[model samples]
Target chain A: MSQENTAAKAAPGVEKKEKPERDIHNLGSSFIFKPNVIDDIHVKAELGRYRMRGFSLFKKIPHFDDLTFLPGTLTRFVIEGYREKCETKTILGPRAKRPMELDIPVYITGMSFGALSYEAKTALARGATMAGSATCSGEGGMIPDERRYSEKWFYQLIQSRYGFNPHHARLADAIEFFIGQGCKVGMGGHLMGQKVTDQVAEMRSLPAGIDQRSPARHPDWLGPDDLALKVEEVREATNWEIPIQLKLGAARVYDDVRMAAKCEPDCIYIDGMEGGTGAGPHLATEDTGVPGIAAIRQARKALDDVGKTGEISLIYAGGIRNGADLAKAIALGADAVAIGHAALIALNCNKDIEEADFPNEMGVEAGYCYHCHTGRCPVGVTTQDPQLRKRLNPDEAAERVYNFLHTLAVECQLFARACAKTNVHSLEPEDLAALTMEASSMAQVPMAGSQHTVGRPDMTRY
Target chain B: MAELESRDSHDMGMHDEQLAGRTQQIFFKPSAEENFTYPGAYEVDFDKETEFDAADMSNKDVNLKIRDLMSQGYGSITIRNPGAKHSLGVCILNRLQLTFDGSLGYFGCGLIDGPNVHIKGRVGWSCAENMMAGTVVIEKNAGSTFGAALRGGDLVCKGDVGSRSGIDMKGGTIIVGGKTGMNSGFMMQRGRMVILGDAGQNLGDSMYDGTIYIAGKYESLGVDAVESEMTQTDIDWLEKKLSIYGLKAPNGVENVRKIVSGKKLWNYDNLEPSEKKLIL
Candidate 1:
């Protein structure tokens, strides 16, 4: 009996008479309740809450890859890449005096001095200056090194007003009123006590060893109208010499852009849902905000609807990786684009670091690490510890960032040449076609191999 | 004083010119060759009769005009019939004395570094928001968000103030003589607020490090705000502030209640499980 049973059980295709009972205690894997879902349930059950901390959003949302450029073919002549000169120069905030002119259309987005190491911040400034672009002063305030290094800088006005000073405001080339970020639209900025080093505390005007939670909204202004007043105040403060920019997360893009335009800002910056942050609520980062493609399209439409098409500049950010993404963003009507996570990656973040180098309590490896909020970044991109931060030499990191930016511009020129555009800003929606219906609808472009656009009615068919 | 007399006659002549539809008035014109330098002062008098309209001129032009007058070495200026024009006196970086005879609109005297701004009438929202230093005195009621995000300054409001007053104030002294609207001193990091009148609800909500002195009744206190004993040092400071603003305390110093941050709401982990709902 044992030999026959064993032979039957061992057979590859045979079923034994007494089959192993399904493990009822461990419920079978369910598509509806995935592993992460189950794990989240357990976490909530143990913690008695759903507090989004440390991790970013995990859900995959719509992105720019859904669309493809319709390069010039037989009907149109594609410019020769090596022989032709494709312009990448960009001008921002032309409506105001002292508009920022850059040699390239790509810029370094804001990363606060507190959130990133001093070396990382300096590296970004140096790299941006070398690349003939601008770097932004993120949340806390403008550091001396960054201000001295960056030729052109955009100072961010976060809700918390941490380290905000009028003297610094006057020194900036432009001021950006940070309404929200892509990763956490409705949430405030969070800096754990561990990251609040003495320098960070001084910069933010807070006591050391205290956690900081920036307010979600501006303290004085509540809505768009109030924002208009605040903008006027800032304009008066600057003597109308510098441009003013309004930045927002990509949610309700059309309405927000319209409101922001009415406020008469020189530029509007929209960050898509795929944006990264030092720390954010997991659910907010994942579940909230629209993608870059949709945001750019809607922002353009809003500007057009408000009769502010060329009167105000539009800047796009979030998940912009390379030259192709830059070209696509410009084609979708963004005057310029900003880089964050990609720039960090170029600076050697989450790379070339051994697991042993990481703090033992972190329990993470190089490629899968995201402990920026803990102030224990092994690669030193987001740490405050002197020893850890020393690992990233600003000179070397600046060279890498400069190379990355240079390569991105070169790649963008190639795309622009193939699209038969002399200037990157001249690239239009007509040069693009959507590969999927969702993208076609959002982008208002015709589907590939189809005569009809998704959102608009086809008069030819009618 | 003789210059003042000459200026008075010039102002009258400008008023007649204004009636003749020649409304543009350049009090102290700067030559193109002149190089403007700081640490100077101004004493130009802007009046409605002269048609020196803050509303019609660009902020740049007004600021430039102010700068020019200051560069000419005038130390004090008086404005009459302000009529609530927005941004009347902004970005003045000198140590001048600006006196407004009438009500001003939004952002009046905003971002002044060293100027002593005196508003005789009510002010619009954000009277001195994000102001760095110097003194801002409002004789009447103030709109919402009065003295918001003030880093280092002295703001004295003689009458009632609207909601969210002293919000996000980093380092400053705010003295309110009358009733205050809701959410006063919210998220204040390091500052001193002296309220001699009744205070609205949610006083000192989420404040990090600050001292609030209230002599009158308060509606409610926000999370992490609690009353503490009023020490003698607080009374002396209050007295000094009252004297600076030329105000009498509404009640005895013994009646003033001192409020400070409880330090319990600084971290989320410090909150009790039941208190988590308050944050959410």
Candidate 2:
């Protein structure tokens, strides 16, 4: 390290110190206002509006990695991984005459037809059906092909009611009343003008070539009392044969879940801040809703308080990536877990395929792309454009999705067997230890190598 | 600033050519197929009249009986004492003459495609919601959220209707013989609403695309909802619609104030450089 070499390797903003002991005019950097913060400010100042993007949270929070499962030893007996059966059967909305039954404990959450191209939507439906899982008809309504390929499907009755039809609703195995989602809570959905094609526009009954900002409130029902009637109306329309699930964003989970239970839905789904969206204000995604670890616990507690625990099922979605995350969610009391972004990833969202030039096309590297809002998805998962859509082969993508979903179930079973649980639903909170204090408090689990749980009145008596 | 403007697709390296029939197969094309096969398209005879008393039966029993009747080719059906049960006569996708002799509850006759329904008594909220092609006539007063998300056909209430009538209406016509509650036709996309009597506050608020004719006084206009000049064509249509429903506007049809969208909130116009689409 000669002085000349040091000067060449120094970053652009660095003030080269001539003397080793000199402290004059030397001020440390800001944690709040980093270089990225300045970059955000500069962009907003130029744009005059909140910047929009498609992805989940950009900032790190206490996540599943902080919770480690405690395998069995002398105190507990471990079920043999290779021979024994770890039942992955999951049932949602059991109160209905025909509950939504799944071979695995995981399903693909709704991601609307307008946000994703035809190939991507159908491929997802086919893959989930192969895995004996379910898929939802997100916001802008159902793609006919997606329905044809899917075995079990949920028709979402969103607040916007974009493309909602009773004829279509009757075709579903279940009905989901989408009140809100985790990524951008308290806001309606967003479909930029670029993605609102002629067909998509017709499906949603909106004008073409316009930024379709959906209404956040339901046009029919105004309050919980009204919602109760609305739910009854749907049940009657479905001949009381299918289950009805309420999907809400994770905010004030305990109170929200209690109110949701009062609505008399067969199932309640809470989406955490880790949920991804096709398009939304970037700030909303970063600063809205609680994490999954905390949301599930509060939701489960709320159901218990209302004495609707077994009568009503709880499903959690948001930031769920792998088998470990699935096991952790089930352990935290979620009967089933739903995934969105990870499913799209399996459909080749951010892949640097030979058909795509990620750096040149997306203005970012393949792994760093978060530009689904612009409808220029490099790997063809989100775009409606014909050329970009061609990049994703549905046959190959469907197989990949099935493989990924199959892998997730196996991995979750692995943990269940190691924890001396013969059934995936039997994974309990007692088997997990929190590595961080924030995680310990949020998940309500004891700290690693200690009997104390953070935020509890009796911290030492877990 | 000009150099930084990546407004068009070419700036972001997206292709401009519209590749036809290449990337997407049959399902992607708008003109290809409807995708879903509509269920319960039963054939029935109009002369085969049937009347059922639903006083002692639950809502399910009545609905199932209606299905059984429809499957047996009975088109002219009447139900006595519907008990104002919610979700009565829902998802009827065929043409039939249906009659409710008593007042109905919420979501009555919803999601019907082609049916001529007559309700002799007053109805609760959200009657005839999302009706594709049918005529739902309530002789008495109707509750709030009347004819919500209605797509096609006509929804007529001889008496007053509650708030948020025709909210998110995609198509069809809503005719209120008397006064209506506030925020009627909120966020309405496409449809025609005729208010014969007074309207509550915020009439036609934030409506995307629709025509609202208010014959009587209104409390106030909402965001992006502005009054427009009434044409002779509008007068003729109102006169015909009123005649068909056997209701008269207090004043003549020519005096009704026509309201439409101001077209101000449709587009923000500040497209991020990448949002500008050059690709079709």
Q: Pick the candidate with the highest TM-score.
A: 2
Pick out the ten consecutive residues of candidate 1 chain B with the lowest summed lDDT: B18-27
Give residue A313's lDDT in candidate 1 (0 to 100): 94
Interface RMSD of each: 18.2, 10.8
- Give, for candidate 2 chain B, the lowest lDDT window spanning 10 residues: B1-10
C-alpha lDDT of residue B174 in model 2? 99
DockQ, all models: 0.19, 0.25
DockQ of 1: 0.19
lDDT of 2 by residue, A345-453 (tens): 9999888899899889988888889999888887889988878887887777877888888889999999999999999999989989999999999999999999899
Reference A-B contact fraction recovered by candidate 2: 0.39
What lDDT does each candidate get?
0.80, 0.88
